[model samples]
Target: MRFVLAPSVLALSALGLAASPALAAQEFYVGEPVMKEGLQIVPNYLTGIQMSAHVPGMEMGKDAIHLEADVHAGKDEAHSLAEDTWIPYLTIKYQITKKGSPLYHKSGVLAAMVAKDGLHYANGVRMDGPGTYRLTYVISPPKLYRHVDKASGVPDWWKPIKAAWTFQYPSKSK
Candidate 1:
């Protein structure tokens, strides 16, 4: 009876241990996924910014500025069931132009950053997978200087400009 009971008890223990890993995987992947807001989210699904950035006849000028950036992160989940994961990302930016020689350069252009955080669980343990995360962003905004003809020290054909591309996240006000 003792020998039989020993095997059963050990098997039960193993099963309990196994349950931990699957539950743990959610620690990392649970909050974050391909679609945080939901599949097929519309312009009004998010929150944070104002309108005119979304609609027309707004305070912002017709032709706003633009920017782009990319990020690549590789992860090694030696203990994880999947073993590895990688995510490639990109974002397009928008801004308004300098209006009547705005004093601060940063105000003319927005300073921004975006980062991704991740976690993994295996064998009832939580682990930070090697290189599974990254910080990618556009720190330096564009120059808003008036076009100057160096030789003549005079303005170019275009007028002085205040430019910025505002990407207003959709909200209650639309």
Candidate 2:
């Protein structure tokens, strides 16, 4: 009797698990890339990096906005080898243009790989309602390669560059 009942319960549990909405697939937004010189910067809704913005367990606070930037060698395949080997530093400057909110206007270096594709950056900004924001990302190549010759693994096209992207966060209520 116990064996018969266990099989029925297990089958029902499997059906419920398949019907759960939390297990459904989610679609994430990836922004367009802005080019400057030979570097490329792409923005996205979320990245693999995880960081604490405010006090833990606080419900009422600035919303968490996960941002990421991926730097590429260029369109050509000549620098493909340098993509994974070369590690560069990046600084992200962000500002909320809608109003002078203390939580929104801030700048810092997004110097974490936390992701395989590229550098990851994330923070909790004052985006409780909705507003326009501007972000400028500056990518500086590693100093170790500065003196290294191109033949010794360094790409000849490597250099520091700046890319900017301005976007608006829609109101959550609407």
Best candidate, lDDT: 2
- Cα lDDT tens digits, model 1, 1-174, are 001224555576678853322111011111122211111101101111122233222222112211222212224222121322322121212222233334412212122232222211101111122222221122221233333556544332222222222222111131
The true-versus-predicted C-alpha distance at residue 75 of model 2, in Å, is 2.6
Q: Would you list the clashing residue pairs of candidate 2?
A: none
Which lDDT tens digits does candidate 2 get at residues 1-174? 001224555566678853322221121344477655544566554312234443233122235455556655455434443443333554444333444455645555553544333345434443445565666666665444333565655455546566665666642221
lDDT of each: 0.22, 0.46
Q: What's the lDDT for candidate 1? A: 0.22
Question: How far off is residue 148 in model 2, in Å?
Answer: 4.5
TM-score per candidate, chains pooled:
0.16, 0.54
RMSD (Å) of each candidate, 1 decimal: 22.1, 9.2
List the candidate 2 regions with Cα displacement exceeding 4 Å. 1-31, 47-62, 77-96, 99-104, 116-128, 146-159, 171-174
What stretches of model 1 exceed 4 Å from their correct place? 1-63, 74-102, 107-174
